[model samples]
Target: MADDNPGFSDPVTLFQDVEDLKAQIARLTGLIDRLTAGGGDDPAGPGDGDTGAPAQDADAEGEEEDGYPPFILLLDSPAYDEELRALIEWVEGVLVPGYLAEPSSDAHWCHLWFEHPVAVGRLHALWLAWQELTEPATCGYTGPSTWHRDHLDPCMRELRGRGGPFGGCTKNEHQIAHRQPSLVPSAWRMAES
Candidate 1:
């Protein structure tokens, strides 16, 4: 029989690629389920399409459901409180001590960072990317450097840049003020005559 697929000379390599794709698909399916079910907090509840298994049981079964969720979903999730606690721990323990430099006119930071939604979202995303990239089995030795160069610096620039989310705050002060940018009403919200 003729080879239907080309460029995959090694069967082992092809099998590994297929396995990786399967894992990716599983993760994406779980994400979509969570998104559609509005956080998928109650896996045993209707519309989750599960076998009435609790969410924690799925975790115990070694399913890949414990990955970090998007910030919006995290907010809506029942696990929000727990995730927030962990985020605070990561930010204070790892991010603040290691990544944060002295706040100045050029580099703005806030003591009340958790109060700012934009800062929280950005930092959470950065932390998630850090976790994924820094996994030794995943990205190996270059992971941390790649995370710093690609994710950390850019996210910090957006979070701490001039007129950024923490623009009103300072190193030791929690100004807790933000200007509402001008925006037109959404089309869905417009009153129909």
Candidate 2:
């Protein structure tokens, strides 16, 4: 049998790839759990008392205040639309051709994925991480692997999975007939008791 995808040569290679993916998922899950609980070993997490605030570096706040657009959801920022356009370009030129697998019901996609807020958010995040990690000067040799394991694979899984934003979409199809899901009202909007 001829293997179409040159990336995976044989059945054993494919099996190994699956095993590697499983290991990566396990590691990522463990890392998330550890970070969420504010360090794995601690019963009483970071910040004063049991506040469980994420432990941030002293420079973390400064970085944001310096007008660094670390996220694409900055609608108020002047760069929002430009950043979004760049994201779309990268998705089309790099991600779709390079990373996206053949779409099936289990792993669906839509050409007009930007219409979905969830897809936009996730893809933006993935693109941002890709920029940071793939820079050889900044992240070094292990960066690409870390990005794939910690970011790309997970983001793609969530975006393309059965329960993902593209769940209702089909391969190469862009159906906006169904509106995006609505969120519950914010607590601030509710009247005080």
Evaluated with lDDT, which candidate comes out highest? 2
lDDT of 2 by residue, 103-153 (tens): 898888888898887788899888867765665434445567778988999
CA lDDT of every candidate: 0.66, 0.67
- Candidate 1 pairs with clashing backbones: none
Model 1 residue 67 CA deviation (Å) reads 5.3
lDDT of 1 by residue, 1-193 (tens): 2266675767876765675555446545655666666645744233232322222343322233543244532454446655667788889998999989988888898878888888888887887777666654444455566678779999999988888898878666676556458788878778652
User: Candidate 1: lDDT of 81?
Assistant: 57
Compared with the true structure, the alpha-carbon lDDT of candidate 1 equals 0.66
- What is the TM-score of each predicted model, taking all chains together? 0.59, 0.57
Off by over 4 Å in 1: 1-74, 182-193
Estimate the TM-score for candidate 2: 0.57
Supply candidate 1's per-residue lDDT for 179.
Answer: 43
